[model samples]
Structures are given as structure tokens and as C-alpha cells.
Target: MAGAQRSEGVVTVVGSIHVDFFIRVPRLPRPGETIKGHGFAIKPGGKGANQAVGCGRLGLPTFMVGRLGRDFSELLLNNFRSNRVSTDYVYVDEETNTGVAFILLSDEGENMIAFDPGADYRLAPDDVKRAESVISRSSVLLTQLEVPLETVETALSLAKEKGVTTILNPAPARELPCSLLRRADVVTPNRVEAFMLTGVEVRDVKTAVEAGRKLLSMGAGSAVITMGGEGAVVVTSEDAYFVPAVRVKPVDTTGAGDAFNAGLAFGLAQGLPLVEAARLGCVIAALKVTKFGAQEGLPWREELEEYLRKGVLELTTPTRV
Candidate 1:
């Protein structure tokens, strides 16, 4: 509990940075087939960047630590500044270009995305070490896999050594070393990623329980398995609870996970229980998908609180799974 407190209420995000190019399509084309898109928009995004901005919008003191290419450094830095996120630790790589993600949003709100992880993948462990003071002062340290795994491990290790809570959002899921998982205070994975990490199908609440349990057994302190419309499951050795998602119409689902993570981080920093934090995360994500784009749809603190008061208070309390 005391480990969740920081002098300045800061959240440190160490991972990738990317510029997202999004296009609206009638439907996703089959592989090797070409189709015309309806509209296009370019925006600032990367799981790390999006989550950092989401935290900042929640009125948290957010710091971003990652590498950007010289070409897009100003663009991404300005975006971070506008979002109220600190980019003091962000580095500009002269050799590699900034990372980019191409996302196709279908009319059904489904999306297909691919990435070019240029400067994002170039962050080294020593780079994380250079930001020691920032990480040491953070209430929560959040990271993902878009960057090098070694860099992620280094950050996690440092956070653990400093008694800071650490969250690992294992996107682009892959098998991980036990040592890394053991250091995480929470591991937030989507249904697909949970299945990949544990070999358990998470199509519904029951299977999500199985997968979350399995992930915890693998050494994580806790597992928060997000199942989109089905809501999320918070699992640990002692209990498994289901936190329902708020119902909302979808526009673009690209940033929902990022929003969810940010809410969870904000709640944790505020010392809320794990289930309540997950509840806040689900509420934030549901509201985010009602608009388009990643960072563009994130809610400010007052907006999120108002929505929770009116739209989410009547939902069933978190139920034991």
C-alpha cells in the first residue's frame, strides 16, 4: 500500500512511441486483396504514449520515457506537451525513424493494425537507467512489449528494487521469462493475450478465470484479464472477481485498452482496491470507444468522474468469479 504512494503522484511510462495512421474501411480485406478506404487521419499514438496521455488527462503527473526519431520528435513531443504529459526523458534517435502504426477501422468498430517499430525498438536498458530518478519517484511504472524486452525487464527490475508498483501490459503477446513476470505487481492482458500466455481460452468469464489464475500461477502478483464487451476479470491466488464493462456504442476501439490501463494506474495510485481499480478501468475504456482516435477520445478527470456517477453507479457490484 505504501509502495503505491509517490511524493508528487507521478506515473512513469517506459515503452514505445509511434505516430498512428488510421483509415476507415467498409470491411477488412482478405489477405493479398486490395480495397478502397473511406477516410484517413494521422495522429499521435503508441501504447506507451497513449497510456501516458490518458494518465495525464486523469490529472496524474505522468512522465514518458522512450525514444523518438528525429523526423517526428517535435510532433510527438508537442502532442505529449498538449496532453499534459512530461517528455523530459524522451530521446530523439538520429539514425532510426520514428515508429508508425497503420490501422484499419471497419464499420463494425473492429480494427486491424500493423507496425514499423523503428526508434521504438531501439531503447536500451542503459537508457532506462539514465531515468533512475524519475522511475524512483513514480507511484506506478507501466510498460509494454513494443520496445525491446531487455529494456522492459530492466525497467521492471529497477522499479521492483525501488519498491514502486509495476504494471506490464503484455501486448503482441509472447512467452516471457519467469523472472520478469515475478517482478510485476500487475499484468494487464487482453483475452487473446491471456490465452497466448496461459494456453487457456478466455472467450467468456469462466475461461477468463482459468486464464487469469494460470497467469498468476506463472508468478505475477495479479492478473487483470480484459475481455472487451464481456468486461474484465481480476484474478489472484486468493480471489477471482468479475468487473463488468459499461455499455456504450463503439466508434473506434483503438485506444480502449490504453484508456483502461491508465484508469487502473490512476486508481492504484490513489490506493483503491484492485477490483475497484479494474471497475474504473472498464468505465474509462467504455467511454473512450464512443469517440474516434486513440488519445483524442481519452477523458479528463472531471469528465470521467461525471460519467462514473451517472452511467456506471447502477452496475452490479464486482462479483466473485
Candidate 2:
């Protein structure tokens, strides 16, 4: 395991940015069923933006690199500014509209989403190359699959070439090439995504371990399979263990995964061990679920530290599976 040696370098995030439309309902509607929503609000989102805000709020020097449409570009830019995330590499596309997500949130804290990727898909490898200086200087480069796969590949390849640690959060899961997996220092995927990636049903710790190992064999240096309330399974070349979730009553599940990924990246940038980083991720995700909305629920550095100081965040020994 690597020892802790905190770096002062920045954490660069290359992904999508979106304006989210949230609708709160009593329950998720069945297929072809009509339902009435009780609440509505608009917020800044996108896996990349959420993670960037999360990192910034946790006191990391964060930069966002992605494309936005002319329509909602200002909304997301202002959001980044307020959250202390730099928009140096954020571009505006005159042609396509910004990406938008329609989220149906249930009373049980579960959610269903549909999105039109819009200008998010227009993020090209050239845009990544334009941010080469920052990418090469980063201590940790975090990315997701919300944007173009080629752009993700380009950013990862460049970061790897510069010897930066790379974290890939494979959301909206899809089959990935081993070459892409090989460049990632860490790969984070929720249970559903783990199933999509490895064809293993990850219903329990045993299955999560199986799926995680498969990801390792496919070429990721480390695999963290997030199992929601069951915690996460961490697999590396040396060992595999399960980190128990921080028990909390959830108000909204949106962005919990992004919070986890952001926490993981922050820990790595601060030179913590993989297991410790994953533990931090669990704490962040737990805090995120206890509130409503995506970016709104993320805890600031002071809040997280205070939570830790209260001794409410207990980490049990990771059980080797």
C-alpha cells in the first residue's frame, strides 16, 4: 500500500455539466402510468459538475473541464464559481443546448432519470488537449462517462502520461475497453454499473467482490464497487475488503455516487491509502444522502470535519472477503 504524503496539486475533473429538473413524488410511476408530482426545482448537476463541486467544497483546488450549451451555461458557471470550482476549461457551444436531466424522485429517496446529453456529447478530444497543461499538473484527475468516451480516453491517456493518478467513475454504465480501464488508477461503479461491466449480479458482498476482481482483471489498478447501504467492496492487486457504510437516514439519493467519487479523489490527492480514501468516500456519500438535491446535499469541509470531530463517523475494520 502507498503511504500518505499530501500533495498541493490540483484535482482536475473532465466531464459533463447539466441543469437538472427535479420533481418530487409520492412514488415512482410504473410504466405507462400517470403520476402527480408534489414539488419541483432546478439545480446544477451532471456527474462531473457534482463531483467538482464536491471536491471544491471539501477544500480541494478543483478545476472543471467540459462543454456547456449557450442556454444554461451561465447557471452552471455561476454554480462552479460559488462552489470554488474553476471554470478555466469550461467551453460554451453555440449550436447545441446544454444537457438537461429530468429526475423523478420518490418519497423513499430513490430516483429515476432521463437526460438529453446535448452539448455534453460535443466535448471532443481537442477540448481535452486544450487543457493539457492543467491535466498534466494535476495530482488527481477524476472523470466520468457522462461526456464522450473518446474525450474521457484522451484525458485519461494524457493524465497517465503525466504520471497523475486517474479516477474513473463509470456511471450510466456501459461496456468499456481494457485499454481505457488500464489507464485508470481507480475505477468506481455502483452495483448496477458493476453488473453492467462484469456480468456479475452484485447483490451481496461476495458478488461485489467477484465483480470488483473482474474489473481488476480487465485492467483497472483498483476497483471500488459501491453497494449503497451495504457499503463498498474494494479490490486491488494485493487484497480485497469490504468497507461498511455509514448508517444514516437518507432524504435523497441523488448525487450520492458522485459524492463518493469526489471523496475518493480528494483522499487520493491528499495521499491517503486506498482503503482510507474509500472510507472517506463512504462518509461523504452517507452525508450526501441525509439531505435533498444533488449538489445541495454535499457537505462543506467544515461540516465534514465537524462530523468527524463528533465521533459520529466510525470506521470499522474492513472485512477481507
Q: Best-fitting candidate, measured by lDDT?
A: 2
- Give the Cα-based TM-score of candidate 2 against the true structure: 0.97
- Any residue pairs clashing in model 1, and if so which? none
TM agreement with the true structure for every prediction: 0.97, 0.97
lDDT by residue for model 2 (21-76), tens: 99999999999999999789999999999999999999999999999997988888
> Candidate 1: which stretches are off by over 4 Å?
1-5
The parts of candidate 2 lying over 4 Å away from their true place are 1-9
Q: Candidate 1, 300: how far from true, in Å?
A: 0.8
